[model samples]
Target chain A: AQSVTQLDSQVPVFEEAPVELRCNYSSSVSVYLFWYVQYPNQGLQLLLKYLSGSTLVESINGFEAEFNKSQTSFHLRKPSVHISDTAEYFCAASSGGYNKLIFGAGTRLAVHP
Target chain B: EPEVTQTPSHQVTQMGQEVILRCVPISNHLYFYWYRQILGQKVEFLVSFYNNEISEKSEIFDDQFSVERPDGSNFTLKIRSTKLEDSAMYFCASSDGQGMSIQYFGAGTRLSVL
Candidate 1:
């Protein structure tokens, strides 16, 4: 079975500061990784994905994540964040050609102004 | 950009009552999926539909759950005899069914069972 684990349940950071949300996964075969963000009362939106390419993938919103195969980790990072960046972030994985994704419990990023 | 749309932003109902959640996937997409997230829980896959039929379903999707693409654009999930545990935010998503295609999600419907 495949599973995703997000290390932090809550991460608080000041505005304009950097932030990182840790995620790890356990899968026997090759996998596709994704990071999604959910704003208050909104559906999840894809932030970035790693299917097959460079280990580091970036989103238009200045967020990036690196897929580390050796450590089985895909951690999300941002050089600087704004108050508008506060949201719940989820790490997900899919394997075996099935589109169904197994998601992590999620990390709540709270940007304090 | 195209996006998935769902109806009834929120629904409240009794435990034994049946509920049908509706979704209109992106017009050109060929795959549809349903997922739910209970409060404080991770989002979970319920079912995936293709070619007007179910191609895959999770253990959480049982006999009480059914999906239909009754028309050219509308997809629906019907839950017969809802349970208290059914309370959650249900999301509808769509994809092009291509390899590594990303699924676009709808705003989701919050179901409150009493």
Candidate 2:
């Protein structure tokens, strides 16, 4: 069985400050990781993913997540935050190309102006 | 870019009634799935369908749930009896079935059981 754990349930950050959302997973085999963002009343959108290659993956919107095999962690970070960035973030895992995706409880990001 | 779509953006039903949620995955995708998110909880997998059959399902998908691909393009999820706990946002998603391919999601149908 595979599972995802997000360290924080809520994070409040000031606009222009850097933010990091922590995630960890438990799996017996190799896994693919992903970060998804959901805005108010909108469906979730892929923020970034880690399938293979470089450990660091980045999204177009200044968000990035690094996959750490030893730590069993894939943490999402943004260099600077904006009020508009307030949303819910989910971390998910799919081990061995089986894409059933086990998701974390999600972190509620509240970017304050 | 092609995207997954779902119908009946919101549905209100009484307890013990049956409810069907419909989805139309991307035209070329091979894997379709249904997931749900209860208020203030993480999204949970319900079932996954491939080749017109269920490939995987979660414990939450018990006797009350069934999925069908009655047509080439339409995938439907039926619940035999609606419960208040079943009230949630049901999301329909699809993937290309390629190794590590990311799943695209629909806007989701808000199911409200009275």
Best-fitting candidate, scored by DockQ:
1
| Candidate 2 residue lDDT tens string, B8-101 | 9999999999999999999988999999999999999999998878999999999999999998899999999999999999999999888888
lDDT string, candidate 2, A4-77, tens digits: 99999999999999999999999998899999889998887888999999999999989999999999999999
* Residue lDDT tens for model 1, B1-114: 888999989999999999999999999889899999999999999999998789999999999999999999999999999999999999999988788878889999999999
At residue B56, candidate 1 shows an lDDT of 92
Per-prediction DockQ: 0.69, 0.68
Question: Native contacts retained per candidate?
Answer: 0.64, 0.55
lDDT for position A42 in model 1: 95
Candidate 1, overall lDDT?
0.94
Instruction: Name the weakest run of 10 consecutive residues (lDDT summed) in model 1 chain A.
Output: A94-103
